[model samples]
Target: MTTNRTVQTAADAALWLAVHRGWHVLPLNYGTKRPLGGCVGCRADNKPDHTPQTCPCLARGDGALCHAVWAATTDPEVIRRWAQRWHTSVWAVHLGVSGLLAVDLDTRPDPPPHQPLNGLPWPADEPPPADGLDTYATLAALSGGTVGTDTFTTDTPSGGLHLLYEAEALRWKGSHGKPRPGDDTVRTGLGWQIDIKAYGGYVVLPGSTSKAGLYRRSSTTTTPRPLDPWLADALTRTGHDRTAAPDARPAAPVPVLDAQTGPARYAASALRSACAELAEMEPDTGRNRKLFRSTTRLAGMALAGWIDRTTVETALAEAARHAGLPAAEIRYVLASGFGRPLAVPDIRSAA
Candidate 1:
């Protein structure tokens, strides 16, 4: 297999990932992680009712590449056609289709807002983790395994890491931060800022360039190593393993209904409607904007004591996940919504 270090253009990188790495590749928007605009028939304005699963273009497999990740292909001809049709500076490898998994350790601000242990008890001997990398190192130490830096690795545009590993026979589910219903703590993946990328997830191919900077190979190893047993165990414990049906989506949390009257009922109804709309959002559409809008509304309600903040976050996260937004984007949208100030309903009037 040709080393990714030699690949220059996004097209070449896509080809290399498909042909050499045996991975399904797809084109992303130039200098951005977002997907390219859909074809005429599949555009949001043209067919607002259609989703990736229901799109006729995808069903026909006419190689339209309309649904982004769903259109990922190992076919060299399709990739070449995409390269010609779209100006792609970045591309992604579909991990599920490629039978691979990645541990994404994101860089966090100094004195990170969330703790790496999440809600779990931390080791008394170890100091607090400063970032995802540190959290991962702590997990490795606890699991009796060293961090697998020698395997295939890429340095993200941000000062973070992507550790690629072969997922041999294990069908795993991807997770962002652990946003469980009724759990208010800001927990993420196995630890804070750590994410698991598996089925229904993708990682940017090495050599892909984005607005922040270039994603380049950080390790000399050309191939991904088989997942370490300890790491695999960690993934299973953290809810990455798919034990039941493969197509099953995580059940969305039921919004808290402390009271059936007044603003409480209104807030619950609003939460359900917002989540449903979010779940129905199509790929490459205004998903981010919709998420921001929905979350802002819910955050205001939570602040007004009409709803639980954790429930709102959990519902939104799951709904956005179902809508196919990436984990990182979901987190960002949630944070933005929570931080923004919005008008709250007049509880006295409703009462």
Candidate 2:
């Protein structure tokens, strides 16, 4: 929140971030978000399987700045040494080390006509969002929350927005390093143009210049606000909470099949049981396999005309989501399960 000091260079920015904000800082290649290539001994060709955990470079503490964000440090002396070594380098803040979570809202062309953006279902009464900002607003509106204007916000070179929030108490899997194939633009499961930077992730600090332009503060407040409750709920719902565990109660109550009997009742009962099991699964503990199995069973029932495919999909999707599987993963597992040959016995025969 301190604004007394001026940041004239990347080193200055890094120092301010470390001294003023207590954020862990790293050196990024000038004009790019990439970390400087590893030192000779740590290069990929020298050691293809090299990792910071196993490499001797990190232990040496020689201020080599190897292993990208893994080498982020708040030590002023080390940062100053980095400034001398990589004079033109920009600054990057290691989000996890700094206990920050940044919501990156990107600007891009809307999806082509007819195809849903990120295959996400939009509200029936509202038009699809045009960009990450719009998508964020839509999400906030849906969650009975407002877009936080008081948080620490920054504007990227490409006219995108970065909303930084305190996330010291929360932890999630994954990183914001390199983009995966076909996922370069929008982050899967979160939204169309929004990306989350959390554990194992880093964000370019404000005042750092890149190829496009400067990353500058856009908010009046310089400090990151506490994570909004609604936004936290959204993150949890979208599988961003790795700490989530199975609770005593089911995620959702099993609907009563009051009007159904015979084969229909059997199919509904199977679905209810599957959903219950899914809702109680532990994180990273074969949730995908469980979802696929349930999907396959319910899919077979749908194929046998004892249950509706849409009904099966909706219920299973909700259950899997509650189990902390991301939306994209849920869809992929469902597709795979549905593609398999029908293997379930006819409900009438079972009855």
Candidate 3:
């Protein structure tokens, strides 16, 4: 019996080590969950064998390392010792990361998920950050010569530029951008923003509509034209030519919502689902590109639902309030996309 007890002790220690290494150790405290917190640099919460020297913080490491040491040690004295040491502003990093989660929980609000792109184009690589207008302009200029112009046309309160071009012209501009979406910002490099619809096609600047400008798509392959021929000829030519027909409406989302209520329900559902899916699609470290298309799909769904003036206006007000976005030119996103009615959520609701 004594020998068996010794062997059992050894096995328990081995299992604990395995658990620290992320080997899926079974629960020891019955209902108690595994430790979820850890050192950010070395992932100490998930890794147990890490020593103080191996601690990513020790080589100039800080509170993250301290929390990690306390986290890894089972001894109460050691835990207390490390907890007392290595405390500082760096602790704020851990708190900041965890605080975001805590605030989301306490506020019972879903903050806009972290958008990992430099904002600078007709179609933003990421959702614009709060107070993002100035940064957005700088980022937009990076693509200045690529395929489109960044100018705002809306007369709203906040001023920002929109990318303008004929429906046929945007295709060339999106493909030629530098440090572009998915490549420079998100680092997944899977795809770039492609405009599939034609209409007002205005990108809104965040702060003041009065300052909003417009941009037309251009290409290095061909010399850039000042404006669409229809607009240019109307300004220059004497005779009216009916050769270019008005832009046609692109295909709409299937089972489009007609009523305002239907679209509202759809947009809310899509936004929540998209955020949940984004969390799942990217690794915790946030190294993934699939999120772009996934986010675009959400935006597309929202834009489709926006077709109803009442639904979009209401939802936009809510999303803006929740996101802390300024009211200036918020609806320009809808104008830029193919206006379609969202059908999926509405149909599902009926069922």
Candidate 4:
């Protein structure tokens, strides 16, 4: 029979939109269960002499407080307007994801000190998909061709690499500057770029470890260097072996939890740390470095190695805390407006 439980499912979906997709609505905490109810666990003395405590989910569970208007009208432009109206402030916006791959073994013996793992050739005019959900899947399908299938290892106790396909691609150029693709080359505003140093050890057999390096097409002016022989061999064994092409899929509208508890929370946290990294800034360029992108790449590395979001989030939070900043501040900026030059709190001061 149709019951209250059925209705709650739709309510839960609405809540997700509010948190992830910038829906302009409020969620009141009412329940004591995994999903929120009308101020869950809160009690009040609405007696002869006292007033009842206001419910967190006043209209949520009790009636129809959770509305659909939030998701229906939520958009970047609208969110910007809401921020201005509500005086909402954010720290930074983060974009893109990076992953690990099997390097051609022949080149691993003496890989370049810093080179892209592989060349990703995506069109410059590729528009971002509608929502976070679609963006990841679309990019994954496109990147799967280039990154291919592989196992990645991380510092987690498992020591086993996570099987990866593709990761998300986000941009906050309005708040943060964009990564200029192929500065000296013809490609600009293109999709599929990499950080030269985000590489971890390359994948080999059960016990062997290999350093990382970038590869280039023979047609490109760059040198074809070897980083790991096994990776290189793997590349040769696979077709194309050097470059990846874009798989253009429209990003889907998948509502997820807030950055604090979402799948991409780790990436968001790492973007903040990367942007604030002292060493990442280029003395000459002043602010042309791709540190955030590199760090996001590292998150991809974790994802590639099958590091769970919880693990990545924990490690990145620890790193940011050690670096001295509120963990949530970074995420707010990326989800909202990136590179907007925010005044984040000093973590050291909290101590």
Give the best candidate by TM-score.
Answer: 2
Better of 1 and 3 by TM-score: 1
Question: Which lDDT tens digits does candidate 3 get at residues 194-250?
Answer: 121111111211111111121121223211123444333321221112234434321
Deviation in angstroms for 149 in model 1? 1.5
Clashing pairs in 2: none
Clashes of each: 0, 0, 26, 47
Candidate 3 regions exceeding 4 Å error are: 1-260, 280-289, 307-350
Residue-by-residue lDDT tens digits, candidate 2, 198-241: 88888888887766777888899878998899878877766678
Cα lDDT tens digits for candidate 4, 1-351: 223443343233333433463322322122211111222233343335322223343323323222111112223443334333322111111111122222121211212111112223233455533322222233345444333222222211122121221212211110111122322121111111311111221111111111221111112211112224433332333222224443342121121324554334544554445534523333444222232343355455354442344443433333333333333543442223223323332334643
Error of 4 at 91 (Å): 33
Taking all chains together, the TM-score of candidate 4 against the true structure is 0.16
Residue 152 CA error for candidate 1 (Å)?
1.5
Give the best candidate by lDDT: 1
Rank candidates by TM-score, best first.
Answer: 2, 1, 3, 4
Question: How accurate locally is residue 334 in candidate 1, as Cα lDDT from 0 to 100?
Answer: 96
The models' CA-based lDDT, in order, is 0.77, 0.73, 0.29, 0.28
TM-score of 2: 0.65
The candidate with the higher TM-score, 1 or 4, is 1
Regions more than 4 Å wrong, model 4: 1-123, 145-351
lDDT score for residue 234 of model 2: 75
Model 2, poorest ten-residue lDDT window?
A: 176-185
Error of 3 at 219 (Å): 61
